[model samples]
Target: MAACGLDFGTSNTTLGRWQDGAPRLLRLEGGHVTIPSAIFFAPGREAVIGRAAMSAYVEGVPGRLMRSLKSVLGSSLLEETTPVGRERVRFRDVIGRYLAGVKARAEAEAGKSFDTVVHGRPVHFIDDDPEGDRKAEDALRGIAESIGFRHVSFQYEPIAAALDYEQGIAREELALIADIGGGTSDFSIVRLSPERHSRADRAGDILANDGVRIGGTDFDRMLSLGTVMPLLGLGSPMRRGDLAVPNAYFHDLATWSSINRLYNSKTLREIEETRRDASRPELLGRLHAVVEGERGHSLAMEVEGAKIATSERGGARLDLGWIEGGLAAEIDRDGLVRHTGDLARRIAERIGRCLGQAGVGADAIDALFLTGGSTGLPHVRAALTTCLPQARVAEGDTFGSVGTGLTLEAARRAA
Candidate 1:
């Protein structure tokens, strides 16, 4: 079997295998194309993914839902101590399900079980939270072993992404890969060989790497607060910042798997009473024809949806109709630019610094390879254009490049 490549990312996951001298991306189960980095838990302790999960969530049964499990890979969740459902599910257990899902998709596509898989790991994934990261990596390795894989390996995400772009690059050409992903914004500098055409012949070593735990996800959180929160005045004069207020919103958002964790009987009760006590005028007088109690939560959800869409779609509309009784200010593309611009600039600046430190000038970066779903934002593109004026910024398939490269690395080492 050709080596399987897995770019297991924070916001999206992708799988590819080599066939007929090219990498073939496996299509996911849903008609949907992207390998989304999200999962949802249903009432029966069953898991839904991609479209089905996203749909169940629109119906509003929150709690025990998990999304973006990749970021929490190295966490207490690994121990499975945090109990989900009647059974205990460790961080790896959840991850195993996700991996298994992807594996199944690939298995179906290839008409056979994949016996070898290579994983993409962040350089700091282990050191970031030493004990936990170790456990997380072990957990991932364990998954491959359990599936009867005979060989498995890991490659640094940025380096792997860099190799993906270096192939077919000319000799002595320089390249930089800015893997602005969901949980992190990281860049890698490398010098390339003219003969580079495959991961095996890439003939290069990593120059330098720098990363910050910031990416598109952070921007989403910021918009939730600076833009989406006050609409309901989650914090009144007395409760401002207390009871977690908007911070609670993020706490809820941090995990996309189970939305059920966010509310309890008491919290739900509070929401009910708060809805009555809130004067329509307090929200926006009669100017807003909608935005009642449930609408508030719905509105919050809609904003998140719009933001995700805007990331991919470039611009999305936030329809106030979702808000039932009262409405707050509208969120437009400009609002997104306002809240996320600083972050975009910071990421670009970091990339520039990494290039400088490696003694590779921006002009020498024959191409700036980009990965991660967050790189789709216009401002991020603008920042790169301004900072790397002389280089070609190649946009790799946001979801699959890392995994395919990692898989190629594994295959080369084994060969």
Candidate 2:
């Protein structure tokens, strides 16, 4: 029996364990330490998770593909059910099934079962709602216990990243840890030192923790609305008086967690009704094709890919030929900034709140530590760095730092 650390991120997951005097991320999928947070249920077969889940859906396998399962916590949707083959599965159960699979993989790789664990959680699961935040953590703890972990504890995600960063530092410093993932952006200001790494309690060192629900998914949604939704009649006029196509359908389509809600018959009927009155029936026809074909997830995936491409290469072309012949959109770095700039501002503002909570000036910070997949976005990085011009920037494993730090926590607790 061993204690493991789990990072159930919105975009990806990783499990780590303390070994050989350090925290080591265990391989979860065929030598890959990190796996996409995805699951697919193909008719009568068992659910497949991680990369295989994404691959199965992309390859056109007949199934329900669920991504961003972590986003359901603390929401009414968690108790709601979605059709999974011949069964209606609650979102909570879906999350449990996914975590169970992840646990099984980690155990198999480590050749041992884990009955105790440390889980990483965002600073605020639902920003500004204390009850919702508490509910989310309780729900996650319940899920972890239900999955056979007899003892489970949680660490704030950005704080966990700070712990990992502390392991390599030689001196004490006031550091701001930024963990921007698929579903949320979390920040923490802490006094970290190699000397403090082995301390059993770190309450005094942690100054402030703050976060927002905005993250990579929000960026994807904004980018989609800016670049792709127009072709689907997002802002086009309708035949009716003074009406444009309602933005609700386009928004749901652009959001990863809400995409599936647009795939049912009721939504289809709504699209049809709207299409009948749309001035540009051709655009509505494209929307109809997307809904009727249940291609919302596919479209979101394309948008996400393009966002990544734009971040890395400064631009990317979105091919929507599958939705309609010759349908495509071009998005460049400038356009991405134009659409997602507000989100970046909100994130930066949250950092200011964090600084205030810590009672420290920006220049007083010695270092800025960044982890999480979304931190790779150029504009997002610039926003954080710009806020602290004098602080030196430090980077952690974008997808694994939190889990690795959780492993260290687990080891400490076990000891």
Please tell me which predicted candidate would have the highest lDDT against the true structure: 2
lDDT: worst 10-residue window of model 2: 255-264
In TM-score terms, which candidate is top?
2
Q: lDDT per residue, candidate 2, 1-415, as tens digits?
A: 5899899999999999988999999999998999889999998899999999999888999888899999998789998999887779899999999999999999998889999999999998997899999999999999999999999999999988998999899999999999999999999999999888889999999999999999899999999999999999999999979988899999989988888888788988988888898899889999999888878889999999999999999999988999987889999999999999999989988889999999999999999999988888999999999999999999998898999988988898888
lDDT of 1 by residue, 311-372 (tens): 66666655554444344446667878888888898878877678777876777777777777
TM-scores of the models, in the order given: 0.80, 0.99
CA displacement after TM-score superposition, residue 258 of candidate 1 (Å): 8.1
Question: Model 1 shows how many backbone clashes?
Answer: 30
Error of 2 at 357 (Å): 1.0
For model 1, the local distance difference test gives 0.65
Where does candidate 1 stray beyond 4 Å?
A: 30-33, 44-46, 59-64, 80-88, 126-135, 147-150, 168-171, 198-204, 239-246, 249-260, 269-301, 308-316, 326-329
| Cα RMSD, each candidate | 4.7, 0.9
